[model samples]
Target: KRTSLSMGEIMTIDVFVERYKDMESILNDVLEGTGANKKSSNKEQELNSRISGLQKIVSDLEKEKEMIKRVDEARLT
Candidate 1:
């Protein structure tokens, strides 16, 4: 049971990392288009807000992944 749970957690960490990378790519694309025009400033603002939220989620997931790693290591001992 413990081994399966640990494996599941490890899988979750991989998924989270993949999602973070995707979100980061999207954020970078949005940022790159910032100077294209002035009319879509509002849209840019909305995208920025969403990107910030995703950033926070990614950060939290990373911390969770680290915590899980520590727990897994402790279990090995």
Candidate 2:
């Protein structure tokens, strides 16, 4: 039981890190205009839209991580 719980925590942290990295990459691309030259304004808009969506996902993940931390603290206590 303890091992499974620890594994679950590790998995959650890994996923959170992955999503955070993805968000950072997307943000960098949007800010640096990387790969924007090949596409038109519409493509740029699409990229912007995707960035916005990813930002929201990242925000939610942060909230979830905080919640998990709190839960773990409560369990420890």
Candidate 3:
């Protein structure tokens, strides 16, 4: 069992404060360092969506070109 200490055995307030300071620094580092991967993932998703839209547009344009080529060939023959 731990015995209660007299006034001389008490810890200073600065010790607890320093511990909290260390915790705050660690939290800041974790937040800053870990956040970049999430940002990169979001950017990648945005680019992929844009590329999918462009692909659909390209497909439609290709179909139109094929129809135009068929009509032009028929006229020439």
Candidate 4:
């Protein structure tokens, strides 16, 4: 199967950047409350570790977002 975005509907860099920004804010809220000192002491570190993993994923997405913007700019010619 094949699908394509018509020129009129193609997403530009702004869309990807805004998406990254939204994701960052949501992750920030989630991590702030789930960190290592917020609950049953025994599971605190474990839970924080999981949050750390999510942070890594967010970081990767940010990098990809930048790459996407660059690629789109290069295609403008």
Q: How high is each candidate's TM-score?
A: 0.74, 0.60, 0.45, 0.48
Candidate with maximal TM-score: 1
Query: What is the alpha-carbon lDDT of model 3 when measured against the actual structure?
Result: 0.51
RMSD of each: 3.0, 4.6, 33.4, 5.6
Please give the CA lDDT of all the candidate structures: 0.76, 0.68, 0.51, 0.57
CA lDDT for candidate 1: 0.76
Off by over 4 Å in 2: 1-10, 16-20, 23-40
**Residue 11 in candidate 3, Cα distance off native in Å:** 83
lDDT of 2 by residue, 47-69 (tens): 67777777777777767667776
lDDT winner between 2 and 3, please give it.
2
Task: Give the worst 10-residue stretch by lDDT in candidate 3.
Answer: 5-14
Q: What order do you get sorting by TM-score, best first?
A: 1, 2, 4, 3
- Residue 29's lDDT within candidate 3 is 59
The positional error of residue 33 in candidate 4, measured at the CA in angstroms, is 7.8
Model 2 clash pairs are: none
Q: Which stretches of candidate 1 lie over 4 Å from their true place?
A: 1-5
Model 2 weakest lDDT span, ten residues long: 1-10
The residue pairs that clash in candidate 3, if any, are none
The TM-score, computed over Cα atoms with residue i paired to residue i, of candidate 3 is: 0.45
Question: Candidate 3's residue-wise lDDT over 1-77, tens digit each?
Answer: 43333333323323444454555455455555655667646655555555455455555545555565576567669
